[model samples]
Target chain A: MSGDTRHGVGVSPGTAVGPVVQVAPPVRPPDDEPAPADAEAATAQIQAALATVAGDLDAQAAANAHAAPILKATAMIARDKGLAKAAAKHVGAGLGPAHAIEAAVAEYAAQFEALGGYFAERVTDLKDVGDRAIAEVLGVPAPGVPSLSGPSVVVAHDLAPAQTAALDRAHVVAIVTEAGGRTSHTAILAAQMGIPAVVQLHGATSLEPGTTVAVDGEAGEVTLDPDMALLEAQRERRERRAAALAGVSGPGATRDGHAVALLANIGGVDDAVAAGAQDVEGVGLFRTEFLYLSATALPSVEEQADVYRKVLEPFGSRRVVVRTLDAGADKPLAFANLGEEENPALGRRGLRLCQAKPELIDSQLAALALAARDTGADVRVMAPMVATAEEAAWFASRVAAAGLPKSGVMIEVPAAALRSRHVLAEVDFGSLGTNDLAQYTMAADRMEGELSDLLDPWQPAVLDVVAAACAGGSETGRPVGVCGESAGDPFLALVLAGLGVSSLSMAPKKVAAVRFALSLHSLEECRALADTARAARSAADAREAVRAAASPELTAVL
Target chain B: MPQRTVTIASSVGLHARPAALFVEAAQGTGLDVEIGRAGEEAVDATSILGVMALGAKHGEEVILTADGDGADAALESLVALLSRDLDAEEG
Candidate 1:
């Protein structure tokens, strides 16, 4: 049993070997507790507990700058004078510190819960403070993730988003959860943070808190008390991967010199700055919705331009494709909240929402134009979810009228892909949003996990729609690109290039891998792979066919 | 005691980051600061819960009252803070 290995789904790609540290679940106060003989002393004791909890939270917030806002907010709940006064009064009435704190928090929690919306979420914060105070008073280890002093593998029954957010990421070498899947918050965040993660490892939390565990995220294997040789081998493999990726850089091209402009997908000014530093060709998908999504009012053209300038300024002369504010029923922009809808997925969204509020679209266009001119960057604005040629033309003219350099339409809808020539004629470029194209083609909700199978980008139908969109671009001599999750997948990136996509944009972290994938084979080989994938009967079959035909090196990394 | 009235400039009103910042600033002053909606009962400006419970929205006028030697200075600072878009700076 020296080589005992437990298998699970590797949600993130990497390997880590460290001691396990189980995050203790929130402790509950005993329902019944005898009152202290001295009422004043009991009240003082609870007050000290509250202060200690508050101090701990304040220290934690100070330690991690990113968690300061949330942690400081929770610390306020703990140090709340009103909460303390009520709890002390309860203690004066002969209730125990734990019970008093719980009751006091509950009183505030009810008020917050009644307020609804964003306020309603604060009840959890209040409860967390209550839990900490209760744990401190009872002399128990604090609930939630315990602070780590060394590199560790965090073992949890299931990480709540709050706990996941609060974890001291520097100390966490790997994350193992007994529950959650690839799409779980833990997995998604782990991937984004570049952490090695394994999910659904049934008994991960049962491991002794300080025992060593070797986690292989790529292989989805957890080895308990792994030997030195195994750890060294894993380290060597990681180094090799790093070396391979380091070998490929600059503008992406195949061995046969078929140039594919590999660009980064950026969400905000921060993302734009970070991605701009990476080895990508340029910014292919500068998502502008994030700026609008976080605002309560429609930002003025100047305010919007300031944000756009922040994003475009970093890229300089590099091409930056910005998607205009694309919010609607589901996303619900605060300035233009359309309210509850029967079918938000099929309802007014993206460009459709822009039509309902031309002022919003016009303001955004003016801002983009101003930002483009200010930075001297090549900015091509795009419209999302454009279904018809008229909508595409409407968006292109608006973009031109605002003095933006170029216009493009996201080919996300099936209608746009099928009648691509008409849509392509109205726009300067076509960017296939494969994720949504798959969702629309299969009539699957992009968000609903149950419909995830139908939304798989590897499905032949999805590829066919993408091919149609690409063909439209080729016919019109307009450049076509992919700015979807599919573009990030290196093997799929090849298929896209084969289908005539001139560029690919994805999360900045994925650039190195996709670049490496492109460097392996010629454009003709990519076309053959795409042909093989399209001829498959199913998504699984398509993936397998591509894998079978792919170079061994591609299969190894993918 | 000194008091100043100011309109909330934060688009999200006097809650979230704005409320937190206001409470933090009030606590920093070490003076008894009370804030209330026009003609309403004042709550402790240092208490996040009390401040949040006010449910003040954007463009709503609120009165700030402070006691102690620096009371006038504190009220003026708070009023100035409330007049500007505090949330906008954070974003």
Candidate 2:
């Protein structure tokens, strides 16, 4: 602690000490640029700059398969003949090369924004291309994450999805952002990649590059210029944590043998393969949105089944809980978009979106059914954003019609959690998506990093909601599970289990720590800890109380 | 000169991946090709930005015209590409 400490929200767990690498914000064209001496030379420079940006993006696309299509499309925009002509016209009118490029991008951006929906989202991509070309023309470093030379901490105002996708996983040890909530793309990507990450860290981008900083992801603290002793202590704790995690394996349970199924929350085939190879029980949340997110049209049933089969085949005879397409205004599909909405979070999303386009859900269910027939894995289907028994029943009926074995609903809405018994009766099981549950419970936007205090999972109101949902599951004799970022928190896992959640699903990297926590407490101890947390007045108090009540061994490494 | 009129089949219309693919194919043809809605001004089909600016929605009819060598064959190929859902294919 012999250094200045800055606090933020910890979205991923780990510890690292590395030199800071500040991500430069998008560059803007200087307003006072003199007209080029020769218009012909200026136009040539603009074309050359755009071509260089396109060439760089083409190389990036060739290197990363996951971001290939996006990068390639962006490259196409960079090499666009129309855009070049527009810039040339501007340069002919005596505008500088950089200014000309900016004007040209702005024109297209305005058109795209006017179109709205999927087109509006592309404006970011278009503007990103503009920034790169401008930087090239002005002879400055490009915006976004630069190539890492060693293990370093990446500090940024916020990372765009394309920037996060292009991260060098091997060299980047930690991620710190000045803005983002727990469910933001940066948080989710860092957690998925098992990198130490902290978000909402004030003045994070102001940290000098090459200055050493020690980041404690669990504590959400960054210590600038830490002493040797503190660094040594962090290294020891990391090693001890790894050793302890390696000591535990197999199914998750309490010391007294109260069985709690530990599972993985996976998005695609790659995650499935990686998590399946880990020592977890099975997949608790198989998010099906990835299959549709990148596509311009709904995938054919066979195409979806092929992907589903590949995901399922890794876990033989193990349960794979598949959540159907959860797209809405917030994460709109290109083809299934229900137009624009003023409030996407509260609008037609999840079950509501499915209801609007029955064909979308039907095809997904049909594909899951077909894939289940092909694989040995036990697959169950669920719908997200379900708020009532009627919605649950409607989804269950659709699942049955599709010939799926079991059906379930995500208990995210506070209304659904409060009346879980009735909802559970209509479905086989339920999983609490605590992230969305917290958002809806607090009536706070999950994307707003400044309001993260209200969205904390440890909040008494959110816990009470989870308890209500779990109570419904118990009353109906159906198992309820938690499959959210909260589930990955080792301490919070104890509180959830105490609330009678039968299962916990999280990033596979987090399973060992949670399993270790569960092993340190009996069912009674966990229940008592839950009671203590519920009795606390605030989220911070509840967290502190639970930490104080937990086993010393669990608290030591944490 | 040769031309054909066809409806866009990609559910998301002529934007994103479909627009990129169409533009790439049009450029590959090395013919002067143009696309637009009936009774509307046409744009260079080889320009990705121009094709996207058309804002063609799914199932909307768009006329395609091509001139020079192998114009008919290129128009026929372009029409066939537009008839099927190009977005549905695996990238």
Candidate 3:
């Protein structure tokens, strides 16, 4: 279609060729004073813009009924009095009705972000309303290339919320954003939708609409204008891999039929509910920090109870292991503000901070206990960064006193793993937070992209920690689960299963792949994978060894 | 005006739960009490946000003050409450 096009990191692995679909950003012409030159005329213009945006949203909702939930949520933002008043303020600030809507929406979004949580979530919805209003005001399509007839990779400079949310999963084979990160909304949503995506490309949007592209999400590389052979190969691989993984279901059981729990690691109560509502076995890890992080002050006991209740309700009687507030200096709280630390990751965090502030721990435990009592959900509470047996006992006792049935500790610290037997001796269960465990064992900063080499869960030392913790778990007659990014990798999941982990908790999208991996190998075969990984000299070697031992189908997914 | 000084007994000092508890206790009293570090201008004790904003540390001395009816008794009770660890009681 045009000269060779190039772009940024290819995160998801796939290939697609499609007609170029150009998505223009929502246009907002500077508001010109209406001919009437009165407040009432400006008001009517704003009203008309809002009505058009609402109608557009209704049309979209009808087209994608499944999007009703998010759309309804956005409508509330569109109708928010705060947003309306703020827009009116912008008019007084000397902006036209169109520009005023943008200004007001942006202001409200910023304020909501400052408030955080239920309010912060409104930011996305507000932005959506603003985008639609601006688009309607300018009589432009709502900033997205829609209705692609064939499977294609979507390319963009930096996708806005409306653009990303509007993506049709059926037509979008992959996503390549020129500017974004792993934590960016586009990447996260793409991952959620199970669409391969790469971000942080230099010239993603410059590619002609409807061009052939190949993306390797795992390798984080993109090849623009790929030759026909490479495109075909990627397409074939994607199909075969998707088919193979789809064939797997049920629990993550060993080849010999030892049932290993396949769980989901969720970020918040909503995620926990959504993941737990699935046919999957249970939730291996539910991160509770989101509630605290989303609030400017500590969430009240009642507020925490409501969130915990929702998270536990979906799983019903299934096990839902909740990790208590794991925040610290790195992700400090507004109220529990720990002053700036030189090395936040290694500084006060997880159980260490809990120990210092037992009251905070007590309130959390009390809330969990109250929620458990109300829900009657099979729940277990755990603390993160537990190092000593005393810490484990301290946390366990507190949890028990709060009326919770069981208490567990996350074996992420090297010391805890090395002495897991003693640590597990004090708790009802142990779950390996391998991401942090690997980071700590290798003494690598997780935020350092360059140190990604050392942070691999396959690292020999990291595997040793898993094995040791599993061993400790075995000694205590308590089960342990691996809940980290590694658990999603089929090969690494197999290795963990081989090492005696009773559960693998990861993203919901990765469940099928792990289940397939576990089914392909017998306990002996998986044990061999773990042993080989243990014998490997480096993280890369360990990964290679695991890859060599696993089925090609599973290895490809990895 | 009545005033008394007491150490921040809670391990995390006067932040989060302890601060919330202090604010609650102050609310229970019908007085316009102000809490502040000794020698520092006191702030409204009824304001949990304000008391937490003080960020008083463990072993730090904070003065409680109030005016009018029952102010003396309210200050005395608050001083006693702040001198012992509430977390220990709960534990």
Compare the candidates by TM-score and give the number of the best one: 2
Candidate 2 lDDT over A357-393, as tens digits, reads 9999999999999999988679999999999999999
lDDT of 3 at B60: 82
Superposed by TM-score, candidate 2 places the C-alpha of residue B2 at a distance from the truth, in angstroms, of 4.9
Candidate 2 docking category?
medium
- Cα lDDT of all candidates, in order? 0.85, 0.90, 0.74
**Candidate 3 lDDT, A302-417, residue by residue in tens:** 97898889888888888888899898877777677666779988899988888888878898988888888898988898999898999999998898788888999998898999
Measured by DockQ, the strongest candidate is: 1
For model 1, the DockQ equals 0.58
Q: lDDT tens string, model 1, A1-558?
A: 335789886766778899989987777778667887887888888889989999999988988888888998888878889888989888888788888888898888888766544565667888888888988888987878877789999998777877876888888999998876645566666766677888878788788889899998866789998988998888887887788889888999987999999998888889888988878778888888877875667889999999899999889899999988778777777678776679987888999999888999999999988988888999999999999999999998898899887999999998998888899999899898887788899987766554655777889999999998888888889899999878877778888888899999987877887899899989999999999999999987997798789888865754
Higher-lDDT candidate among 2 and 3? 2
Instruction: Quote the positional error of residue A348 for candidate 1 in Å.
Output: 3.8
Query: What DockQ do you compute for every candidate structure?
Result: 0.58, 0.53, 0.02
Arranged by TM-score, best first: 2, 1, 3
lDDT ranking from best candidate downward: 2, 1, 3
- Model 1 chain A lowest lDDT segment of ten: A113-122
What's the true lDDT of residue A488 in model 1? 74
For candidate 3, write residues B1-91 as lDDT tens digits: 7778788787556754566568778878977888887667787787543564466767788888899898888888898889887644652
